[model samples]
Target chain A: MSHGRRQKPKNLLMILMLSPYLLLLFFFGVLPLIMAIFNVPTKSPSNPNGGWHVIKIVLHDFRLVPAAWHVLGFMALFVPLMIFFVVAMSLMLDTDTAPWKKWVRLAYIVPACISGSVAVLLWYVLLEPTLSPFKGVMHFFGITQASQIWKTSNLTYILVFMAFLSLAGQWILIQFGSLQSISGEILEAARVDGCTQFQLATKIKLPLIRKYVIYMGVLVFAGGLQIFVEPQLLNSSVYHGIAQQWSFDQLSYSLAFDNGNFGEASALSLMLLVPSLIGALLVIFKTDMFEDVNFKSPKKLAKEAKKREAAAA
Target chain B: MSIDFDKKAPATPEAPRKKKRKISIGHYAVNGWLIFWAIFSVIPMLWLILAPSKTDRQVSYKNPLSFASFHGYIRAWKNLQDFNSGVLAHWVINSVTYNLAIVVFASVTASLAGFVISASRIRFKKTFLISTLIMMLVPPVALVIPLFIEMNKVNLIDNPLSVILISSLYPFGAFLSYIYYSNTIPPEIYESARLDGCSDFGLYTKIAFPLSHPLLALLAFFAFVGNWGNYFMPYIMLPSPEHYTLPVGLGALFFSTPAINPGNGATSVPILKPEIALAGILVAVPVMIVFLISQKRLIRGMLAGSIKE
Candidate 1:
C-alpha cells in the first residue's frame, strides 16, 4: 500500500528520458495531422475552410471514397479468407511435430520478412503473358493478354494473391504463438473425454484464442484497407479494372506527389484517419491488450521442463 | 481404478478395436496438405531466384525455371552496376547507411521511452501512454501526405535526414518496448534503487539497459528489415536517383515501365524480363538471410512483442 504514498515524479529527468518519444510523436504524428487540416484550401472572399471543399469534392466527384471502397471491399472479402487459413495452418502445425513440419513452417513464414513489394514484383514477372513462368498453363488456357487476368470478374484472384503474400507469414506466426499457449493438460483432458478432432478444435482451441483472433482480425481489416504497393506497381500494366486511386493511401500519395494537390491530399488523409483511429480506440479499451508479457529465459524453461519430466516419470 | 493421464493422453484418436491402417490415413492427409502448402510458398521464390540467371529469351518465351546460364545473371549484375553510371551501387550504399541509422535511433529512443514509462514515475503518464498506444494503430498511409508537407516546409524532402529522423519516432517499436518493460520490470526494484540513491539515468544505464538485450535485438531487427524494404517513404521523399534506397530505386525502375539498362549507356533498353526478377532478389536476399538466421527468435519475439497478459 506504501506504493500509493510515493512522491510525484514530475521532474526534468523524467522529461529527458521520455523526450525522444515525445519529440517524434510531436513532429511526425501530431504536427503532420495539424498541418494537414490547415493545408486544405477553399476559395472564398476571406481565405478559410480548405478541407470541406475537398471533402465535398471527394463526396460529389466520388474521388476518394469510391476508390477507397474497392480496396475496402477487397479487404472485407480477403480478411475472413486469411483468418480461415491462419487458423487451419496454425492448428495443423501445432497438432504434430513431424520432421518436415519445421522446414514447412519456415517456408510459410519467409515471405513475411521480405517486403510486400518483392512479392508483387515476383508476381509481376509470373503474370506477364509473354514472360510468365506459367506460360505453358496460360497457353493451355488460351489466355492471350496479361490484361485478361485482372478483369473485374478475375480481380478477386489478384486481391487474394496480394493479400496472402503480405498477410500470411505475419498473422500465421502470431496465431501459432497463441495456439501454443494452450496447456497440454487441457488438451489431454479433452482428448480423453472422447472429443473428436474437429470437435476439439471448435469447442476448445478456437474459443481459447478468440481474443487474439479478434485482435488480428481488426488489425488486418484496418491495414488491408490501406494497401498500396500491389495496385500502385500494377499502374504500368494493362489492368484498368483497378482504379487510379485503388487504395486510400495511394489516392493520398497520387494526390500530393503526382498531382501536386497537397491541399486535397491532406483533406483526403484526414477523412480516412477517422475510421482507423476509432477502430484503434475500440481495440485498446475493449480487448485485454497492452498488458505485460513476461518471458522466461530458454535455459530456465528447459530446466523446468526437465524437472516436470522427472516428476512425471 | 484410476487411469494414468499420460497413458490416456490423446494424440491420434484411436479406438481399441480400430485397425492401424485407419490411423495412418489421417497422418497421410495432414502430411499431404503440408507438402502442398510448402510447394505453393516455395515455388514462386524458386522461380524468382532461377529466373535471374536466364536470358530475356529464356525467361519469357522459353522454359524460365530451368537453370541455363550464370552468364545471364553475370550480365544482368554488370548492367545493374553500370546502370546510370553505377547508380544502383549508390542506392545499395544508401540502404545500408539508412538501415544502420534507423536501427540505432529506433532502438535507443523507443527503449529509453519505454523504460521510463515502465520503471519510472513520469508526468502525464496516462495521457502520454494512451497517445503512444493510439498513435501506433493509426495507419502510416493516412499521414504520408501531411508528413510530406511538413518535411517540404522544413526543406528535409530529398534528404536522408527526413527518413532517418522520422524512422526514429516509430511508435510500434516504442509500444513493443513498453510491453517488454512492463512485463519484465517489477516496481519494487525501482523503489529500492531510488532508496539506494541510484540516479534516474544511473538506474537506466546500469540496471535497465543490461536487462533489455533480447528486446533491443528484436526492435533493432524489425526496424532494420522494415526500413530496408520500405518503398513508399523513400519513393515519395527522394525525387532523384542519387538518393534512392534499393526498394525506392527498384520501384522507379519497375513502376510504370521496366527500365533495365542494356549496358549500351541507354537508361531504358528494358533488358530481358529476367532482370526484373533479379532486381527483386538483389534487394530481398539480405533481408531473407537475416530472417533465416534468426528464424526461431523472430517468431518468439513477435509472440512476446504484442499486447498480452
Candidate 2:
C-alpha cells in the first residue's frame, strides 16, 4: 500500500514536469514542422480540382532539386575554412604558457556573445565604401568600392565569413575544453623526447582531441548547412535565389509571410526537419559526444611535467 | 573477493619546481598579435560610443570616428519622445519587463528541468536529451513563420504575451542547466539525499539549487542577454511601435529617418546617427554588466567542454 502511494505521486510529478515541454513541442515544433512539410504544393486558387496536383507539379520540377544542390554547393565552401579555424583554435589551446592565450580566447568567444543581426549590420556598414573606415585602407590596396560582396556572385564567401565569425567561438570553446582534458604529462613526455612546439601541437594535441574534433566537426558541419539569417539579412534577393526555398527556413518565411504560399512555405520548413532529425539520430545512436570525458588529473599531469622539467635541468 | 583489505596506498610527494626562465621572442610576437586583435575587438565599441554626437551632414563630411552634433541628438531624442507623448519610455519599460520576466522564468525552469534530467531517477533520459539538442539546432529563423502562424491561430498575434510566452521556452537554457547540473552537482550528494528521506524536489531545492548558484548566475546572464538582444522574434510578433523592443524600435528609428544615415556617406553626418549610436550603446550595457558580473563563470563554461562535464 505504501509502495503504491509513493509510486502514484512519482508518476504525477513526472507528468507535471513533462506537460509544459510536451505542450510546447506539440504546438510549436511538431505542428509547425508538420504544417510546413505538407505545404510543398504550388497551388492555384483558380482550379477547384487543384488539391494534390500542386504537389505533383512541385515534384516533377527538377529545377527545385538543383536549387537545393546549389545551396549544398554553397555549404561545401565552408569545409576548408572550418578546417583552418578548428586547427588554429586547437593550436592556441595547446599553448599552455603562451601570454596571448587570454586575448586569443577573448577573440574566440566575443562573436558568440555578440548578436548575429548586429554582426550583419556591422558588416553592412563595413562594406559601404564612403561610410566605412576601411575604405581608405582598401583604396591603398588598389581596391575600389562596388555594390558590396553580397550584391555580387561572391555572396558565398560573405556568408562563409559570417558563419565563421558568429559560430566559431562556441566551437572554439568546446574544442578548447576537449583539449584541456588531455593530460599535460603526455605533452611533457613528448617534449622530453625533443618534440618542438609545432609537433607537440599537431602530432600530440590534435591526435589526443581527435574524437572531440570529429564531434565538433560533425556538429558545426550540420549547423553551417543550416545558414539562413546572415544570408537573408545580407541580401534581400536571396528570397528569389535558386536555393530560395532550400534554405529551408528563409523560404518558409518568404513563402508564408511574403507570398502567402503557406503550403510551399510549410513544405520548405519541413525540409529543416530532415537535418534536425538526422542530428537527433546522431545525438542518440551514433555518438557519445556528450557523455565521454578526456579529463584526466591535471594535478598529476602538472606534477609529472614538473619533475620531468627538473630532471631535464 | 577481499583478502585482507588493509593495504595502505603510498602517498606521493610534490614534484620539484623547475627554474622559471626568461620570456622568449615568440611570446612577444604572440602578445603583439593578441594586442592587435584586442584593439580590433574594442574598436566597434569605441565607434558605438562616439557615434551619437554627429549630425547626418557632419557624420558624412567629417572623420566618421568623430562625435555627432548635439542638436541632431536632441532632435532624435524628441522624435523618440514624440511617440505617444513620450510613451517611447513605455516601450523601454516593456522591453525591460519582458526581458526580465524571460530571464527569471527561463532561468528557473531551465535549471529545474536541467537538474531533473541530469540528476534524476527519470526514465527516457536519452530521448529527453536528444529532443533538447534537436530543438537547440533548429535555427530560430526557421521557426518564425510557423510560430507566427501558430500564434495567430491562438489569437496571440501582435501581443506581448506571444513574445513573453514563446521566448520563455529556451532550449539553450535547458542545455546549460543540464550541463551544470550534471557536472557541478555530484551524483554522490543526490544518493545521500535520497537516503535521507528527501523527495526528488527536496533534493533539488535544497542540494542542487544551492550548489548550482554559480551556474544560475551564468544562465541568468545568457537568458537576459539573449532576450535583450533579440530583434526578429519580437519584431515579427509585435506590430505596434508602442510594444517595440530596443533593437526593433531603434531599427525603425534608423531606417525611416533619412536624417539618420545607415552608413551611406563617410562624412554625410546623419542627424540622429549619434542618438542611434547612443541607443546601440544603451542596448549593449545590460549585457556588458551581466558579462562583467559573470565573467569568471562565463570563462569557466567556455573552457569546459561541449557538455559541461
Candidate 3:
C-alpha cells in the first residue's frame, strides 16, 4: 500500500479529508466515554460505595434482575409468533408460490411502515381494560374481572402486545426482503429435482435465510430491552410495577429528570449500555451472517465462484 | 436506463407454466391468519380516533368500542391549546426546535464522519469504523449516566441545548451514513476526482455529497422521527415544563389524569382525563405526518442495499 513520490499529494489530501472525523471522534466519542468511565469511580450520591457498588447493586437488586428477566420472558412468549409470521410471510412471498407477490409484500411492510407513536396510541384503544373485546371474552369466561384487566398481574400481556404491534411489521419486512434475495432459479432447480414447496422451503430456503432470522432475532431482542415509550405511555396509569423508572431506561429517566439525580441516572444508563454493546459485538463478529443478510458478502461468493470454475477447467 | 429498469422490475414470467390454478386450503388458512392479525393491528388505531369524543364517564359507562360525543375533541383541543394559556403551543415549538437542531447536526456530522472515513485513506479507518459500531451498539440508556454527569458538570441540566447536544451524536445515523458512503460511492470516482486534482473536501462536497441524496433523505427522515418520538432521553434532559417534547408532554398528561386514578370509582371524584381519542391523535400526529411524507425515500433506501446481493 506504499505510495511513490506522485502519491505525496494524494496522501496529503487523504490526511486532510480525515482530519474533521478524527477531531469529532476525539472530542465526542473518545472524550465522553472516558468521562463516563472516570465518573463511574467517584462515590456520587447515586452510588455511595462507588462504581463497582453501583454495578453490584444493579446486578443484585431483586427488582432489577427480575424486571430484566420479565422483559426477556415476555419477549420469549412472542418467539413462536415471530417464527410464525416470519416463516409464513417468507413462504407466501417466495417466488415459487405467488404470481403477484407485490401485494403480499405491501401487506407485510405496511405495519412496520406506520410510526411507532401511532401504533402505541392505536393499541391503547384496543387494549384499554374496560373496553377491549378480549376483556369481555375474559369476563364471560370468568378468567378476568374488569378491575384486573391490565393491572400489574397482566402487564406482561400488554407489554407483549406492545412489542408485537410495534415490531411485527419490521420482522416481516426483513424476512420478506431476505426471501426476495434468494434466486428463483435455485428454487426452480430444487423443484426440477422433485423438491416440494414445503421441502424446498424447509430444506433450502430455511437454511439460506437462517442468518437473516438470527440477525433479526438479536436486533429485536436488543430493541425489546429498550422498550420505553410504549410501556411508559401505556402502562403508566394502570400498572404499579411500571415505576417512573421501571426498567433500566425508565429508571434512568427518573434519575436524571424526575428525581434530578443525574449521577444515579448516569450509572443506570451505563448499566443499560452493556447488553447493547454485546448485541453490537455479536453483529460485528457474526461474519457468517454479515454478508448474507445485507448482500454485502459478495467477496466470499466470488471466491467460491472462482474455485468452482478452476475445478471445472 | 432501460437496462436498469429491466433489472429493477421483477422478472416475473409473462405467464405461469401451468394453467388456471386452484387456491389451496393452506392459502385460505394463511390469509385467515394474516387478516386476523391485520384486524388486531388495525382496530386500535380505529379506537384512538374514536375514543377522543367521549368523556371519561361516558367512556366507562358505555362500551369503549362506541364513539363518544364530539365534545371530547373540543375538550382535548382546549387542553392542548388553552391549558395554562396555551403552553402546549410552546411545547410543540420547543420540540420542533430541539428536534430540528438535532436532525441537522446529527445528519451532517454523521454524513461527514462517514464520508471521510469511508472515502479517505484514514490512518485508523478500522478503529474509527469499529468505534462507530461500538457506539451504535451501546444503548442510549448506558450513555444517559455519562451524559447526565457531563450535562450537570456544565450546568446544562434542564436545558434544551443539553437535549440537542446529547442526541446529536446518533450512532445509528452514523452507521447509516457509513453504509451509504461505503456501498453507494464507487472508489473509481474518487480516483478520478484525485486525478483531476480535487481536494478531499472538494471531492466530498462536489461529488460524493451530491451522489448521496437518497441516503441523506433517508437519514433525515429517520433522525427527525427518532428524535421526535423519543421520550426517555428528552424526558430526562429537559425538565422544564415549557421545553417538553411531545412524548414528555404526553407522559405528563397521562400521569396527571385523575380519571385513571379514581380508586374503585365508588369514592366520587372528578378526575380530569382529557378525551382519550383526541389525546391519542395528538400524540401520534407528528410521526404519522412524517411517515406519510417520507415513506418513498425510506422504502427505497431500505430496499436499495438489500437487492445488491
- How high is the CA lDDT of each candidate model? 0.72, 0.61, 0.62
Question: How high is each candidate's TM-score?
Answer: 0.87, 0.79, 0.82
Query: In model 1, which residue pairs have backbone atoms overlapping below 3 Å?
Result: none
- lDDT string for model 2 (B1-309, tens) is 011111221221332122113235664565565555556555555555555566555655667677656675676566556643665587689889999888887777777777777665555666666667677655566577667767877899888988887887767777777776766768888878767887777777788877877778877777786788787788789988888887676665544444334343232333255555566655765665565455445544543335332
- In lDDT terms, how accurate is model 3? 0.62
Ten residues in sequence with the least summed lDDT for candidate 1 chain A = A42-51
Candidate 3 local lDDT, residue B24: 58
TM-score of 1: 0.87
Specify the highest-lDDT model's number: 1
- Across A192-233, the per-residue lDDT of candidate 3 in tens digits comes to 676655677789888887766766666666677766766666
Q: Give candidate 3 misplaced runs (Cα > 4 Å).
A: A1-30, A45-54, A78-84, A93-122, A133-144, A228-236, A240-246, A250-271, A292-313, B1-23, B54-75, B263-276, B292-309
Q: Residue-pair clashes per candidate, as listed?
A: 0, 26, 8
lDDT of 3 by residue, B125-207 (tens): 55666777677655555565566666767998888988887778766666677667777788789889878878777878898
Cα lDDT tens digits, model 1, A238-303, are: 343354777777777877767677777777778778888888888777766544322344356569
DockQ leader: 1
Task: Please state the error at residue B171 of candidate 2 in Å.
Answer: 2.8
Which one wins by DockQ: 1 or 2? 1
Q: Which candidate is the best by TM-score?
A: 1
